[model samples]
Target: MGAGLAMQTAVNAKLRDFVLSPYLSSGFSFLMAWVFLLLLNLVTRQPLLISGTFITHNPSWLWLGGFFGAIALTGNVVLFQKIGSLQTTVLPIMGQIIMSILIDQFGLFQSPANPLTWAKGIGLVLIVSGVILSLGLFEPRDPLLKAAERHAGKGSQLFYQLFAILAGMLMAMQTAINGYLGTTLHSPIRASFISFTIGVLSLILVNLITHAHFSNIRLALKQGPRYWWIWIGGIIGALYVLCSSWLVPLIGTGQVVVLALFGQLVFSALVENFGLFASQVNRMTRAKIIGLVVMFVGVLTVKFITF
Candidate 1:
């Protein structure tokens, strides 16, 4: 699922090229995923309408997963423009790890309570260190870091950074909430469809408010056939969402987040090394390899070690 997410990122980047607006591309992607899950639920004989009993009995927060997702998507775009991609990536990850830990420790969103242990603490540190190393952040002169530094005033930068962390926390909360929603609905597929539906509606509102060029949608359709691969971003994203909803209940949210992060980093390294999808070639360095090893160790520590 994490690898699929990385692919979705690449595919969405290409889709953004055709649509000429990230908001439009994201909304379109959500629309496609919504349609896909709608069909899946229909074929699987799942009820299209959510029962009133389920609605009346469940907490209202269960329904906010998609709204949170939409906000996170929008936040990423804004952060990408305001802060460099490096900070955009790292800050959210930090937020995700921290939030996931809190959720697991406190049994937030009705998730199972798994109090933090010493081994888990060590694993968290290693995982964070690995992320920093893999991104080459130890070098004070990294171009992306310098670019981010030049982009904002100190106060504004701190605000954007905090917003980025909040976005990440929202992402983790969304996963946990959706997992519970799936259990309540008795179908992860339906939960995914509903999530996408809400996300699409939210994005539609955002696009309208921002005056996003709807003309780009028509342009993208005309040019879409030439780059058929871009259309699959939504499908990939749908699967990722479905898997996250399904997995969270089975293996706590923290594990799901860590495992997915590991997959994302590993697959992203391969993508950069191979120069796939017209991405720039950045051959894997020793630091990246060492970081991967550390990340792997961290994953094991978190997953298998208890004492």
Candidate 2:
């Protein structure tokens, strides 16, 4: 859990750097992650550390899952730049709560549990209300008045918010894919390694086609991007995806996302207000404070109110 928090912090910081494109950060992060995992394997002398069974047994799900993961990463990194970390993170909670209900109740994704009950229903409502409060969606005025107002305007902010929400939905897809993959594939690490590598490669291709910033690439490699801290964001993303894929099967995707949301609330508060590790400290507002509390309550209810 601590490791996941650290990785997420790295991701948020990378987004703030406003550096060599979101795609670049994501791709580079995966490349770096591949290297990081390899290094660990080399140092520990554990060839089995990240097994090959993931590819041998069921290659299709890894590829399919990688596709959604790429989308999720692109949306999340961009949304982080636009909507701020806390707001962006909350969007996933909303999607996961909804998706979990449908998937679990109907066995859409072949979830271990089936047929959602009243407890889950009530928990979902609480989560929805908490998201509204946390996001300040219910407030009449711009909920983020104290925070940096979107330079783009209402339409732009709305677009960014939607991007954040879409990122969440894509992540939910990735969770289901990973859970399915986990069952057939023996090693979680190997499956994660492959999925991230494919996703990262895909992002690179897309980025080169869209932007084709050869000059920026040269500069980033040499001196690093303007905000190099953003690289940590990639590292965080790599670790988070790997671990999340591993954990979600054991616990449901809904539970894992809920836990992650709780972590985001605390980490985002520190990142935005206190500026931990020299990160930007966005202004806090009264509505946001109240919203944070509401989110906490929602998390507690979701965790304990199991049917």
Give the alpha carbon lDDT tens digit for every residue of 147-261 in model 2: 5465457788888877776666767667676666655555566556656667777877987787846355555445455455555655666677667766877997657766777
lDDT of 1 by residue, 1-307 (tens): 7777666666666677778788887888888888999999889998888778888998899889999987786666556546534445555766776787899899999999989999889988987787667656565566785776677566887798899889888988998898888887778888888888889999999899989998887776787456788788788888888787678879976577668876766676676678666555667777767877786677667656898
**Candidate 2, superposed: residue stretches over 4 Å from native:** 2-18, 39-62, 138-151, 221-228, 241-258, 276-280
Model 1 clashing residue pairs (backbone): none
Candidate 1: stretches off by over 4 Å: 75-93, 140-165, 222-226, 244-259, 280-283
Best by lDDT: 1
Q: On a 0 to 100 scale, what is the lDDT of residue 210 in model 1?
A: 84
Candidate 1, which ten residues in sequence have the lowest lDDT sum?
A: 80-89
Candidate 2 matches the true fold with a TM-score of 0.78
Model 2 RMSD to the real structure?
4.4
RMSD of each: 3.4, 4.4
**Model 1 TM-score, all chains together:** 0.83
Best by TM-score: 1
